[model samples]
Target: MRQLGGTELKRLHRSWRRKDSFRLALLLEDVQSPFNVGSIMRTAAALSVSELFVSGRTAAPGSPKAQKTALGTGRYLTWSTHEDVATAVRAARADGYHVVGLELADEAEPLAAMDLRRDVCLLIGNEDRGLSASALGLCDAVGYVPQTGRVGSLNVAVATGVACYEVRRQAWADAPAVDSGDAE
Candidate 1:
């Protein structure tokens, strides 16, 4: 495959930068590790996430550890700090987003098979505890990244990337097909 030039890549990245667009929001709850927070922020930025809402005792994006891991991506991504996850969920839902929690629950659907529709808000929880009952209750649906390895699950940041990519992939796939109307 051909590689994109620097200008082409910049244009592609800039295509999704809509300040007022409510495409998707990322909800981070009670995440303790700064490195994980930073890594998620980097992924969020690259994916053109509309906003990031961090709640509970999650590490702030301005911290040194976050800066080190995020490598300046946080500077481009818009984020807000919330005191609680419910408030974040409420605000996002009120804005017409379908809140989906990324967790491995008994009833959770696998990411690969999920058909995400409309605008979505991705909820990522603490590493050790996952989503609290109250927080999970607010989700429209729960999703999991299927794994075959002995390790039960993936790190939060890694899992977040997989989930985010799936959402993007599905949305792109469902988009109106383009017809060049020319011979291949």
Candidate 2:
């Protein structure tokens, strides 16, 4: 077994990017920790999310602490911050994305069970508060990552990573195969 070098790593990802057919965006609502913001930014880049909508008190990736943690990965991502969650959700919907809220709220289905479409705008909430009632009302659907551990919820950043990956993994599975002519 061998690990891919930096160039090979790029090639591996390029293959997936070439085959990706769906669009995914993220909306953060009041997730205040810079480390978490930076982590989500990195994850968004890694997963090829088309856009990011940051709302409420979430930290911007350009902030010093966030940039330090993201290592400047946000430069590769397209993001915008809105005055509130509703406006962010509206922006995403205007861009043709299906808004799905990722929260542990009443009536939310399991993440894997959600009927995701080709373009998804995932709405995440504050680490402490989760989604507000009004924010939840803005979603077309709601999903939660089903957990069996002692903890009832996951860290905001970790949950974002998982949700983003799940969204792409579903789209990728249904996308046509494309060979980038590079050895894996």
Candidate 3:
């Protein structure tokens, strides 16, 4: 096959972008940094995550730092801003989504072993204070990315990306197998 030219390559990439579907959503609670929000948007878009829910004073999607960090990802993904985390979680659950929180509480199950399935929403908390009791209580399940090093935690965006990828990976694995009717 002939190699594509620069214009063709651009078109191909655009087609891929156009064909992308948002399967997952990232729910941020009280995340304070615009740069972090932007970074997460970029990662979410790359992962085909459909939407972002920014709650409890998390930086708005239109901020310059977020825009700069997102590197145009904002144009490809949808976002919603909310003042109440529990309300959002309830709304998601009512919509048939299984809510999951990414926090390291005593009750949190390890991310490596968690089951990530359809109709799910992944919740992320603030940079410093972590998730509030009310927010944590709203979730159906909570998961933690195990930490073995000296540092106690990861940046909110990094943790979000890790958790998102884990859910996506598990979803891929759990997909139903297909078979042809004609046998050998």
Candidate 4:
């Protein structure tokens, strides 16, 4: 119930860094909101995503709003921008990653059921339009976060956070247990 002191928090951060095991990337295609982009950057860093690929009209990580929302986390993430989404997807695929689109298309599967154990490049689309038809076609798979509430969807940033968490959850579940080296 007590707030963690700076020293304790630093130790916790270092411990988390040592346990980083997932190889995940993010591709934001034409996401217009700087706030959303920044928020996504923070979430990506927290989840240990290896990189971010921004394409089309998505806000750059250096944008003021993005920087503000990222709270200094933007510098910790490796990000690149492309003039087109296809180029980014192709590059990710060439690098031995599965490019999955986070969209709500009719053919999309539920996020919880998707296999994310392998290296992943998650493609996130615009706040309003979702993924472009061409972008969706390039993805190896499309997944949507299941929702039962009155709201049909979540904010783009919120959805990205949820998706990232799902990936991390799956990785953690599949990872083999290791000893911490502390004596009982």
Please estimate how well model 3 matches the true structure, expressed as its whole-model Cα lDDT.
0.81
Weakest 10 consecutive residues, lDDT, candidate 2? 175-184
Best by TM-score: 2
TM-score of each: 0.87, 0.94, 0.82, 0.90
Residue-wise lDDT of candidate 3 within 1-184, one digit each (tens)? Answer: 7777877766655554443332577788988899999999999888777667778889988899999999988998888777789777766666667789999899999987987766568888999988999999988899999989999999999998999888777765654432322221
Judge candidate 4 at residue 6 and give its lDDT: 72
**Candidate 1 on 1-184: residue-level lDDT in tens?**
7777877666554543322233777999998999999999999988878788899999998899998999999888888888899999988888778999999999999977776756888999999889899899999999999999999989999999998877877776655543322212
TM-score, candidate number 4: 0.90
Q: What is the C-alpha lDDT of each candidate?
A: 0.84, 0.89, 0.81, 0.89
Estimate the TM-score for candidate 1.
0.87
lDDT by residue (tens digit), candidate 4, 1-184: 8777877766665554554466889999999999999999999988888989999999988999999999999888998888999999988887788999999999999989998888889999999999999999999999999999999999999999999988877877765553432322
lDDT of 2 at 78: 89
Q: Candidate 2 or 3, higher lDDT?
A: 2
> In angstroms, what RMSD does candidate 4 have relative to the true structure?
2.5
TM-score, cand. 3 vs. native: 0.82
Over 1-184, each residue of candidate 2 has an lDDT whose tens digit, in order, gives 8887888788878888876778999999998999999999899989998998999888876899998888889898888989999899999999999999999887999888876757999999999889889999999999999999999899999999999988887877787785643766
Superior candidate under TM-score, 2 versus 4: 2
Ranking by TM-score: 2, 4, 1, 3
